[model samples]
Target: MSLLQNVSSPADLKGLSAPQVEALAQEIRDFLVESVSKTGGHLGPNLGVVELTLAMHRVFDSPHDTLVFDTGHQAYVHKLLTGRHDFSALKKQGGLSGYPSRAESEHDVVENSHASTSLSWAEGIAAARRLSGERDRHTVAVIGDGALTGGMAWEALNNIAVDKDLPLTIVVNDNERSYAPTIGGISHHLASLRATRRYEKVLDWGRETLTRTPVVGAAMYETLHGVKKGLKDIVAPQEGMFEDLGIKYLGPINGHDTPALEEALTLARDFGGPVIVHAITEKGRGYAPAASDIDGDQWHGIGKFNPETGLPFEVSGRIWTDEFNEEMVRLGAERPDLVAITAAMLIPVGLDGFAAAYPDRVFDVGIAEQHAVTMASGLAFAGMHPVVAVYATFLNRAFDQLLMDCALHKQGVTFVLDRAGITGSDGPSHNGMWDMTISSIVPGLQLAAPRDGEQVKQQLREAVDVDDAPTVVRFPKGDVGESITAQRQDGSLDVLLDVQGNPEVLIVGVGAMCSLALTAADKLVAQGHSTMVVDPRWVLPISDDLLRLASQAQHVVVIEDNLVTGGIGASLRSALQEDDQWQPVHTFGVPKRFLEHASRGQVLEEVGLTADVVSTTMLDRLGPTASGRSD
Candidate 1:
């Protein structure tokens, strides 16, 4: 049997010897490489944490111990060791999730896919354990040093250190990158210390010897310690950052070494207060292709690729991101006042090309989404048109800023929200379905959803040109639909299909859902049921003409890719209800629940937003009417 087969849980890991553990680490890496290559899940982060995860499981009793993983993409190895060995269906429907799932395993105590939130969770769990009068149980949080850039992690650290004696082990996994090379003050500080090798060695030796010295005793020790303070001032300058915060700081240990990780974790377990073990690990360590690349973002979350060739299985088509990037470049060229900003998502949001072309205009505000939004607002206040491009999920972190800072002020900022709907594979935390629902509530905020490539460029230009209030143009993560090139030059709405005159059923499609609506319309047309498909480019400032068309139809079916509650459909429903002539309407979209990890197609099919399901549902609704029975 393989070394991995012998391990079912952390308890099973306790029986293995040191050499056996070392062998298991290699086995796990091999399994990870093979599995992730086929499944196209998180490859680089998981590869770096194989030994660290093994050491963690060996040292701590999970579930009981309350071990939390910040940005749980690195938990794949943890998932493997905890009896989830089926990587064939990783991130698929009803399979192992890309991140930790509460339903998947008891070992996964927290379900966090976003970074910098684990420490806060650890603090609460640790405090709860203490409140219940339990002392033996440990609460450990494994957070990346990159995640430390986020303000929430520091807030947790500050709160946990208030007591100065709280038992919490914070493992700082310093891979030097969170998607991209980590930026900001904390990362710079860590980099400075990592560069000064001799200073670190001296400090380690001094701490070890000064506390254990016996010959000098009381008087001599105190005298020497006083002089040693001056010596430390000359040697290690910023060593007191964590110490002053009332948290013990341990070595920048080698994270790849199982023995070193085991030793550091053992010492951390014995330490009677809040402590951080700073471990330096190489992201994508075992994989040669990933290791050789300086930028880890390409390998961060990848699709199915060949292990030998390192080439992905499929080539991405011209996505909405491409059109956004191209248009932003043209806008910058055309208008000197146009500026673009991103919250550490330059590549994913297609701002990399924009950044490269106009470095001065593009700002990467490092994991700080709140700052990105407010900074853009500030730019807007300065008479500059600032376009803040961010992921739909990450925008949730800046809702307060969006509402108070941007909306209340009515700042002329344009938000280009990529992944604006049900982003399938990354699971609940990463889905962008909430953007429409949340942003719809913000007063004076104009929202647009383009159905195809041509509309994307046109809408983006219009959003940038709107100087009155905040405008948001959101699009999905995949390829753009067929280009709609023939729009009336007078800004009149283009009708893709018009059954408005004598329509039995009118389907209002939003953004990516237009294709599905068109398919449903085709099915209805075959069954001799008159149907109209309208793609309302602008979602907000509810289209009056479209509503009028809906009033003319027998029934209106609103199909969107966002949440049902408080989404575009809800707004439309409200508009129709206020109107006296509009008939009954039914809304179809993602349900009000956390969707699991699956392909985009799978999630759409399950939610009844696909062409087949939409067509079927519409046909069912018009069954008696189509059969000429007016009962």
Candidate 2:
């Protein structure tokens, strides 16, 4: 039987010898390459953590002893060990989640894939364990060096340091990249520790000269440790950041070596106080293609691809990301003071081109979204336009900074939120559905959701023009669909289609939902309903002209891709009602719930955002329709 086949649980792994364990690691790597290549998910981070995960399972008991993975992307190996071998429907509807899910098993804790929250979670759990007198149980937090850049991790570390007796093991999986390489000073210190050549030389010299003899030489070396300590002090004193923080620092250990990892983990678990096991892992470890990738992320996440060639089987159309990236270069050329800021994801968020064109203007602020926004506010205050680009989901971290620092101060910071509105495949926390709702609550913030590539370019230009307060440009993932032109441009609102008849249904489309609006309009026309489709370029604070048009119709249907509550549709409905245009207004959008990990189309269909579904719902509500051409 295959090594993996016999392993249903971590206990199954206990029976295996070192050679068999090594064989299992290879099998797991092969399994991941084959499975992830077919289904498409996080590959690089998983590949790096095989042995570290094995060591963790061997030394510390899961469930009985909590194991929290910061940013959960590295938990694939843990999943495999805990009996979830099937990867057929990975990241699909009714399938295994891409990140850790509590719904999957008791072994999986914290479904979050967001960077730098595990440490805080671990601290709380350990504190609870102490209060309950469950001191025998352990709490281990495995976080990447990249996650250390976030302020929350530092905050947790500070508190954990103070306790001194809290039995928490902080495993810093230093691969030196979050999405792209981590920027700033903390990364530099980790880099120095990773290159522990000076410390190694002192130890190696002692091993060769003094320790070669019998017990007498060893005893002499221990008692007369001046030479060793003197050399180490002058060369490289091993007092690193962890030591400075009053936490025991144990490694620069070989993260791939299972035996060494087990030893390091065992030491940390037994060390009473909070300890940091500095495991030096190579990102995209065994996979040659992943290891050699030069661009940002280095196959951190991928679609189905050829395992050997590491090339995608299908070519994707120009996505929303491409349009924004192209426009950024053009904008940079036009405005020299226009700068771009990224929170350690320059490539993934599509700011690589802008960074390449104007290197000085681009600031890669590690995995610190809060820092990125505040820094952007500072840049904006100094007579410069700063465009802060990040994933829509991650923008939640900078909410306070964006609201208080930028909006309150009336700073001209343009936030470009990539992957907006129910971005599927990465699970609940990854979906960008909440950006619109969050923006609506921020006063003086103008939110723009562009429909197509052309509109994206136009909206970006418009967002950059706002000299006071903050402006936001958000768009969903995947291809920027076919352009739909306005039949009649009315200021900020564009009338995409209009039919002359007795006032009936007015469909208001927001951003990419314009195509769906057109489909519904056409279908409503086939029935005997006079339908008009209007696309409001600026979704928030619905235009006065659109409100006037809403009064012309008997009823209004606001179609959007954001949440049903606190979104553009909700605001529009209130405005129409307050104006005493009290028609039965229907709002179609994503319901207030976390979306599942599935294809974008699949999730949209599930939420009733498709054209057929929307049309049928509209027709049913309008009652019996007589056959007549309204358009």
Candidate 3:
């Protein structure tokens, strides 16, 4: 039997010998490559943490001794060891979730997918344990160097530093990159520590002595620790940042070495206070293709790839991101003052090309979303039109900054939100559904939900033209299909398909939902009802033309890829209600619930956002009349 096959639980790992553990690490790596190639998830981060996780499980008991993963992509080994070996249907509906899930395993402490949050969680749990008098229980947080770039990690560090009494072991898994190379000051300091060799040797010798000769032969620890510190000042005078913070600083140990990792973890576990064990790890460790991945973002997260060639099995068509990238490059050439910024996602949001084209103009602000938005506002204030391109889900981190720093100040900053709606496999936290809902409350921020490639460019151009308030241009994850030219225009709203006379139903399609609405429109017309479809590209600041069209129709239906609660449908319904003609406005959209991982099409069908379901719902409401509503 394979070494991995035996590891059904953390308790199972306790019986393994030294050489056996090494064999298991190699076995786990082989398992990861084969399994993840068929059903893609995070490959690079997981590869780096194989030995680290094995050592962690060996050193501390899980469930009883709490362990946390900051960016939970590295928890694949944890999943494998904890009996979740079924990798056949990973990231698909009813299969294993890509990130840590509370529903999946008791081993997973928190469902953290986003970076720089694990440290704070560890602190809180540690604090709670102490208050409840569970002093024996230890809380350990494994954070990536990339996550350290985020402001929250620093906040947690500051809070943890002062406590000193908190029994939390923060493991810094420094791979030198979050998605790409981690930027800013903290990363450089860590790099300097990595360069400074012999920290491991010196720290190991000192820690061993303390453990060996307990002053007063145990129970009295302060005497021996004080002696070790006094001797350390004479021997190792190079005081590091962690030492300055009043927290015990350990070595930049080799993360891949199972024995070394276990030794370090054991010492930290018994440290009895807040201690940071910095270990240098290689991201995409065992896999050659992933280890040397250009910019590191491609290997960070993947979809079914060829094992031999390391090429993705799935082929994709032109999407909204491609159009956005091309436009940014063109804009860069024409307008020198136009700058683009991203929150450490240079490639994912299609800002790589923009950064390459306008080398000086584009800025990657690490993983700090709030800093990126506020920095863009600063750039705009300095008379430059700054475009902030980021994933739709991540913008939730920067809403306060987007509102106060940009919109309140009337900064000419354009937000290009990629993966705008129903971002399938990445799950609920990733979909850009909340952008429109959040924008509804933020004053002076204009919102755009482009239907296709043509509208993407056109809306982006129009957004940049506005110099006063902040403008948002949002588009979805997949292919940007054929653009449907409008028959006419209603204010800024484009009427994609308009019937001859006063329509029985007015179907307003928001952004990518135009295609879905158009299909639904065809079904509605077949049922012998006058139906018109309008693409409300600009979803917010409720259009004058949409209200007029809603007034004409008896039953008005609004379809969007966002939540129905505070979406375009609700706003349009409110406008129609105020205009005296109260049309029965039916809405089709994603429900305000945490969605699981599935294909975009499957998710749409499940949420009743499909063409057939929407048309049937509208037709059922008609009920043989097909007449204008007189309600």
Candidate 4:
């Protein structure tokens, strides 16, 4: 039997010898590649943390000590150690989640998938524990070097530094990568300390030589310790950044070495105060394909693939991201003032091509979304039109920045939100359902949801042209299917299906839901209800054209992939009410709740966003009139 098979909980790890633990690490790595290759989850980040996790389990009593993981993508090993070994249906409906789940295990805490939040969580937990007089229970936050790029981690660090009594151990898993290679000043600082051989030897020499001189030896070591920060920098450029903050710093220890990680962790745990244990490790250490992937394309967040060949089972078609990618490069060539910014995801949001084309113009602001948004405002102030590309869910982090800094000042910044709505498998935290609600409240911010690849390109150009207010262009996660042509155009509206006379129902589809709206319109028309379908490409600000069209119909049906409350439909309803035009308005969308992990289609169906569900509900609401009875 394998070592992994024998292990169930963190307690099971304690019984194993050092060599046995090393064998278990290999077993875990092999299991990860095999299982994740079939199931498709985070494979690279988890592979690197096997030994570090094992050491953590051995040193700290979890569920009591309170171990927290930043971003939680790397917590798959932690899950396996804590008794969740089933990987057959990972990220599918009713299956294990991609990140740390509170419902799945007690060992898991701070299940938020966003980067650089673990430190703040650890600080709060540690401070509360100290106030409650629970000194025995330790709090360890395992944060990546990539996550440290976020401003929140440093904000938490600044607070954690002053409080010397908190029993908190911060494990800086300096694997030199997050979504991409760790960027900015903090990353460069960590990179300088990666070469620790000389520093390690110098410490060994000091320990052996200084302590041998009896009473004076101890005093001599103490005398040298006063300027140790400078002395250490002379030897290896360790300027004692953490020590300057008043937190105890330890190790440039090998993260893969089980015994070394255990030793460093034990010291940090028993330190009786906040400590930073900086361990050097590699991402995708055991797997050749993953480790060699410098661009972080296939391995970081993967799809189903062959285990041996490391090739994907299916090559996805040109997606919504590809539309943006080509347009960005073209925009770069046409406009000299055009610049782009991303919050650490240089590649995921399709900015890599733009960044390469206009290297100086593209700014990768790390995982600091708030900083990226405000920084775009700064760029706009300098006469450069900045396009901020980021995942829709992450845009939530910068709402204040987008509102106060950008919109308040009338900065002409364009935010291109990728994976805009109902991103399944990654779970509720990842869904981009709240963008429309939040962006709608921003006074001058114009929001657009593109229906197809052509609209994605066309709308993006239109958004960049607006030089007085913040604009948002959102698109979904998958392939932008065939373009749906309109029968005719009415102002900014694309009338897909215009019934000859005054229609009983006006179906307004927002973004990708336009196709689904057309499907429902067919169903309604088949039942003898006069249905007119239109795509208000830009849904925010409640267009006068849309209000007029809604007034013409007996019932207005608005469909979107965003939350029902305070969405485009809600805004339209309020506008019509203010104009004193009362018509029965029906809205169908994702309900205000945390949707569980499932396929996008499954979630849409469950939430009654599908054509059959929506059409049936609309028919019931309309009742058996002359229009419906004609069928």
In the predicted model 4, the residue pairs found to clash are none
> TM-scores of all models?
0.91, 0.93, 0.94, 0.94
TM-score of the candidate numbered 3? 0.94
Write model 1 residue lDDT over 1-631, tens digit each, in one string: 9989988888989888889988888898888888888989888998889888988888888878888999899999999889999889999887899988889899887786877899999999988998898888899999997788777888888898786557788998998888888877888878865665433453454456557766331232234446334232322232457867767666677788776676557656655567787878898888887776577788888888888888888778788899998988888889899998877668878888878888999887777888888999899999999999988888899999999999999899999989988889889898899989999999999999988877788899999988868999999998886865422321334556675366888888888888778777888787878887777788886778767777778888889989999988788878888886557687889999988889998888788788778777777777855467421
Residue 138 lDDT, candidate 1, scale 0-100: 90
| TM-score winner, 2 or 3 | 3
- Ranking according to lDDT, highest score first: 4, 3, 2, 1
> For residues 115-189, what per-residue lDDT tens digits would candidate 2 score against the true structure?
899999999999999999999899999999889998999999888889978989889998888777776899999
Q: Number of clashing residue pairs in every model?
A: 0, 0, 1, 0
Worst 10 residues of 1 by lDDT: 230-239
lDDT of 4 at 399: 94
Query: Candidate 3, residues 356-421: lDDT per residue as tens digits?
Result: 887888887788999998999899989999999989888899989998999999999999999998
Candidate 1: C-alpha lDDT: 0.81
User: lDDT for each of the candidates?
Assistant: 0.81, 0.85, 0.85, 0.88
Which segments of model 3 are wrong by more than 4 Å? 203-239, 626-631
User: lDDT at 620 for candidate 3?
Assistant: 79
Which consecutive 10 residues in model 2 have the weakest lDDT in total?
227-236
Off by over 4 Å in 2: 197-238, 296-298, 501-503, 626-631
Stronger candidate by lDDT (1 vs 2): 2
Of candidate 4, the 10-residue stretch with the lowest lDDT total is: 229-238
